[model samples]
Target: MANQGPKSQTILVVGGGIAGVTAAIEAAETGYDVILLERGPALGGRVAQLNRYFPKLCHPTCGLEINFQRIRKLKNLRVVTMASVAGVKGEKGDYTVSVSVSPRYVNANCTACGACAEATDMEVDSPFNYGLSKTKAAYLPHEHAFPMRYVVAPSAIGTPEADKIKAACKYDAVDLEDKGEDFEVNCGAVIWATGWEPYDPEKLESYNYNLSADIVSNVQMERLANHDGPTGGKIVRPSNGEPVKKVAMIQCAGSRDLNHLPYCSRICCLGSLKHAVYVREQYEDAQVDIYYIDLRAHDKLEAFYQRVAADPQVNFVKSKPASIRIDEEGRPVLCGENTITRELYEAPYDLVVLATGMKPAASEGYVPDIAMEQDEYGFLVPSVEGDGGIIPAGVASGPLDVSMSVQSATAAALKAIQAVGPKS
Candidate 1:
């Protein structure tokens, strides 16, 4: 697949998460042809769902803007969203890839207008909104979403509503007949940056998350806290429209347990603490309690932890919540033994948030012929020599904070460039 006498080689970066995006950008800037494949409809990965990143409290859009601009200007980089790597062939220097792309009804002509959304009758629970809100069949994934285009869910739109949407769009960006296509590309190396998913709380029956309205996960809390959220940034009890007065944050809900995920997720403790601070900020009078077996705050995170603890409105309890049940009025009652006090107590709260652990993304199963290793926890195993043709980065490799994820991604890109050597 060498182009000529002396030129850069091609690299494929799978999974358009932060790590994948960084790898593609770095490789492309080094004069290599880079193909970025994302299973989702857009880039930015899990980080996109987050409202503000920790340490600096930077907005998600702020961090993503640089990469978006770089990708737009780079001629050697091609981003294919709604696509997955189906299979692979050949060796490291020259590999053949089969990419499967999904259909997005809208194209580059989309103007981010709300006309199609206003005309559509279908309403589906928005995954981007974390199920806290509803979106029409023709919807933009999120505010400040990349490509700044709206996509239509064919399954969500009926034939009648679909016709109306086509009529509503003044720009003919809606491609009604666009079907998914598959193609092959030749690349010298591959980078596996597939990210993680939140541990399903339904597996933890003791919390009764699926059955209770007030009990929610950290991700759901994000949606609740977002100004563009379903409730317009109101922290209210799901059972009623009343404001949440008391909030309880549970740490390590699905992590650090031998029966579940054996290793510490590394980010849960700090994430819970961050959410606790968020709750207090949302309701100045709200009493916030954080229950945890151990508060594992690494590096500079301890400073943030100390600041939150110094807040008079916050309570830090060292204990793992044994059970959670709802009261008559839909308040959450948390039962656990306070390890320090050695006393069992049941406290009622207007709302409860479980800091769930991360798992491999659904796209992990679609990885091509790469024989990459994964830990028992389903996280992708990193290469020992740091020279694996497939480089793992970000949350896909393990639990890491936003800054750490970005650092790891840059390192992965360097390794990919090393693998490709001096091009052809």
Candidate 2:
């Protein structure tokens, strides 16, 4: 029999979000060959899309830039974008994983010049903006994209628009013929850091997200407040470009509900609090009302909650809104029972942000076919005591905010190192 130990010490980290990036960087900096794969066109992940983080409210780009610098300095690490694992085979330290790479239709020779984007009139719903804006057929994923590369939408292929884009790239980086291809990566340890997606608010049915333009989800609120966002960092009404002075933040919109996620998302509370901060920072006279079954700020976050609560402009209401209705004047009216006061109330706001919970990326489909084990909630577990060389990092392990995800990613990187450590 072949010697049953790690075939190679190479570590493959799937998902190039904050967690995956941290795992890969940590392992590689520690003298390990690491492969970091991102299923998107860039590596910043959801955090990149945010205006700022909670607690300090620092711009996400600050952290991302530091991480990017670390990544650039690591010689043993290779970053791959637009790639996902279709399957994972073999055992700990001897794994062969199939990778499916989607076509970016842009080649490595390209400099991130705006000529291609300027040449195309065809526009697509900007996923980076969470459908709040549109972008040219050939566009950059975001300004802070790690590779700082451009992507050509599939719709632009096989047309005059494609030719225009190709001709526009003076360096000849546009590859219209670039169809996605599949390949394999051989590694000893695998870290799954697939992140989370926001729960759909429309399912609430009572929230009336579809009926009103002002009822925005918390993530979209992030975009709306971002300087690079569709509204150019202004917290304004979507229906009309009027400044927002009154806002309601609904917490646990889909979390801790037996009918919905059934667990505390752990981030929405802090996120909504941050949203309130954003509003207060933008409008000094803005009145912000936060509705929650119970406040979830724990440990260090308690201070943040306290500080925000101290703001007289910010009101913390103890209730789960029964439903939101649009008045004839296009105002979002929140109707709910105030559990604390035992009263029914209806309030109107120019903008209402829903703090929806997070749903795991692996919740439904496309988990790697390996010894990976999933919990009742679909978050990936160590296949077997993590000895099987499959370790789950960040939100892939459970619901975690940014800071916790980094710590979790570091722990998973250490575990991965041990899994491929010196042989017995």
Ten consecutive residues with minimal summed lDDT in candidate 2?
A: 1-10
lDDT, candidate 1, 292-393, per-residue tens: 888988887888889888999889899999999877766779998999999999999988899998876733476543546666667676535433676777
For candidate 2, write residues 51-141 as lDDT tens digits: 9999999998999999999999988899999999998888887988899999999989878988999998999999988888899999999
Best by lDDT: 2
lDDT of each: 0.81, 0.90
Which residue pairs overlap in candidate 2's backbone? 93-188
TM-score winner: 2
Give model 1 RMSD, 1 decimal.
2.3
Q: Which ranges in model 2 have alpha carbons more than 4 Å from their true place?
A: 1-6
